[model samples]
Target: MADDAVTTGPEHTDEPVRVGLVGAGPWATMTQAPMLTGGPETRLVGVWARRAEAARELAEPYGVPAFTEYGALLDECEAVAFAVPPDVQARMATEAARAGKAVLLDKPIGLTLAEAAGLAEAIDSAGVVSQLMLSNRYRPRIREFLARAARFDTLGAQARQITRAFVAGPFAFGWRLEYGVLHDVAPHSLDLLDAAVGKIDRVHATGDTRRWVALTLEHTNGAVSQLALTGEVPEGGYTELAMFGPAGELRLDFRDLAGDEADSAAGWATVRREFAAAVRSGRPHALDVHRGLHLQRLIDQALAGLR
Candidate 1:
């Protein structure tokens, strides 16, 4: 895909957009389904998964129909929200875009640059409203932090996201264990650093993807960021980002956000509202497929640099 802008389809009047939830995992059940049903801008029209039973189970309480066929779900909804693995998301989301449904995507976009770029091409060709679920970008606290960080001269940044998800819980399963932190965790740090510091120009990395992965990113504006990520931490862990410069140091911690159910709900609510607004207005969102592709490229670069 070229570095050119992708045009959107024509705008429509403000009406509730019918959205289908794809994937029946914890993310879909906990966040996607609730946010889609709980919000006013979008309606939860249906739920679809690779497994019929899982889809039925998730859609039972919500009173929406469960779809065994992906096409049937796509036919019912004006938009689709994905909560599946990156590879699955790439393929299905491309199909949804080609079917003329606005897409609400999850991060990493795809498992590889080729998959990411192909999805971007499909989105561009379809000219539909598309947005990535970079949830933190929707939070008031994170928005405020970005605003404040922009006013400072950031010389460098340090970020770390450690977790025990691979050890237990709903997130313990799937591609997270196979691909490790780079695909699952690095997207958040990479996306935030690109927004806070500058576009990443170069990436250098070292460490093991299964245990620990560390990266040094040189931003286009010359500010560098160091990131350490792992999902195998045994005890307690944290997600933190700090920047230092002549303006002193600025920090944003995800400690409370990680533990606060209300904060997580609020973030997803804002994400859904904005995505529905984009669909109705035919306006491209800041965190769109193109942005996701850019981050995917950065991830590709970092992966290539890894030893």
Candidate 2:
């Protein structure tokens, strides 16, 4: 296809939007990295991993510079995809923001709200584009559910169900469980809930690192949703969201794509693409820095047991 009649979205530019990827993990290697192949708007300019060898392995196939330092990658690229673990998120995000680089951070942006907020503030204060990865929003089914649920009066007296995450087999053997279910899974569900119902008002949660969390949330719109987080049950821990109001019930089965290669990036799904477009227009990203900070604040409260 011609670059002018670009298939991805609007024309990013004739030249690629050079990107530096921080965290050359499996997700980056498979999904996010491959986005470069089909789009004329962007290019994978570099890859950074904690280990230089792993960085080289992931970045080599894409023919980009490989490094063990994120600063090096940032110095040479216009933006970055931050796929690093939570502990290091604030530091890296702050650095990129300080550099005025467009940043795409992975889901559950940070370990705590304070860190996420601080980084978010820096990103915003610097006037840079940034978005957290909540690609589930791009799924067609979820979009449909949001529309149907928007007319709450149309659906009535439906059961609201929330199942805990089930992790077994090799899928169970990872850092996801180590980080616990909420941080790993809530990013997708919480955002969906906020969109479907209104913003969450009060939350009551009960659980621990070893077992499960039963959460009840009151939405600002007088809608309530219960989140049962059972980590790694036999059938596996998947999320099912059902909304019933006056007319019909809207149900969405949200599969956990945390480390899954196929669904990790979820396309030029939502914010990043918006951010990219913003870069072209010389304006702010559609996702904006405030949204990310707000989500981080929510993440923090949950972790802090504020609910």
Candidate 3:
């Protein structure tokens, strides 16, 4: 067996997996809770947050029990959906895995590579179904975009994620503001480029995370991807990913989506469905904890380049 091996194999069952939400922040309240309840393959069993009131408020609408204790929430579910800050996610997710519950995680899984590595070790030891909530990856449109891109002999790519998230909004504060865009926005673009192009072998970066940062990634397939990211834009920000090759350009623009809420709900629904499938089959997903760790490593490399 390889050193990075996760699960033994698929368990193959048909029952719905009981899932619990771990966080009362905007992400859990707005996206996680609603989607988990609406999905047929998984059941939202309970909610846990550091603050009891927050958990109660988020869980009440779904008719699920709210607990202040993490362990109590874990006991009610076979899977955990996390929407907390990276540091908090790293700690709680590790415990969730140790308790033998699968985890649905957010990107840049941890603030630091060490924290991510520790979580990955726990997942490997527990052999639980683990999947990262790389929201775009779960989107049907984005999946189709990737499928089409796969058909081309991709040579190089460009991606940009610009936002005023840090200037104002619910996400303006907290870990996002404290840690900056490297941990906040870079993960999504990095994951997309890695998926659309090929495995990233090296990264050269410049600028600061708080403002604008640029990265030139060298993929193992010899395709290069350039990224420009920032959360301090003046007005409404834009996002686009374009790949260039002899065949022409393949592009994805975030503005083309119907609406943020509708698009996000669609993505979340797919996430719950896939997570449940992985748990039932006992098969590790392509975007599992290990993929999160891989992205973490790439971010670490980018940080190093900045230094």
Residue-level lDDT of model 3, residues 226-248, one tens digit each, is 99999999697999999999989
List TM-score per model, in order. Answer: 0.94, 0.82, 0.93
Per-residue CA lDDT of model 2 for 208-283, tens digit only, reads 6436656676776667777666565664445677676655566666553344544434445334455466566656
Sort by lDDT, top down from the best? 1, 3, 2
User: What are the Cα lDDT values of the candidates?
Assistant: 0.86, 0.64, 0.86
Compute the lDDT for candidate 1: 0.86
For residues 54-164, could you state the per-residue lDDT of candidate 1 as single tens digits? 999999999999999999999999999999999999999999999999999999899999999999999999999899988888887777788887787889999998888
Runs of candidate 2 exceeding 4 Å displacement: 1-12, 154-175, 255-272, 286-288
Find the 10 residues in a row with the least total lDDT in model 1: 1-10
Count steric clashes of candidate 2.
Answer: 13
Instruction: State which candidate, 1 or 3, has the greater TM-score.
Output: 1
Name every residue pair that clashes in candidate 3: none
Candidate 3 or 2, higher TM-score: 3
Worst 10 residues of 3 by lDDT: 1-10
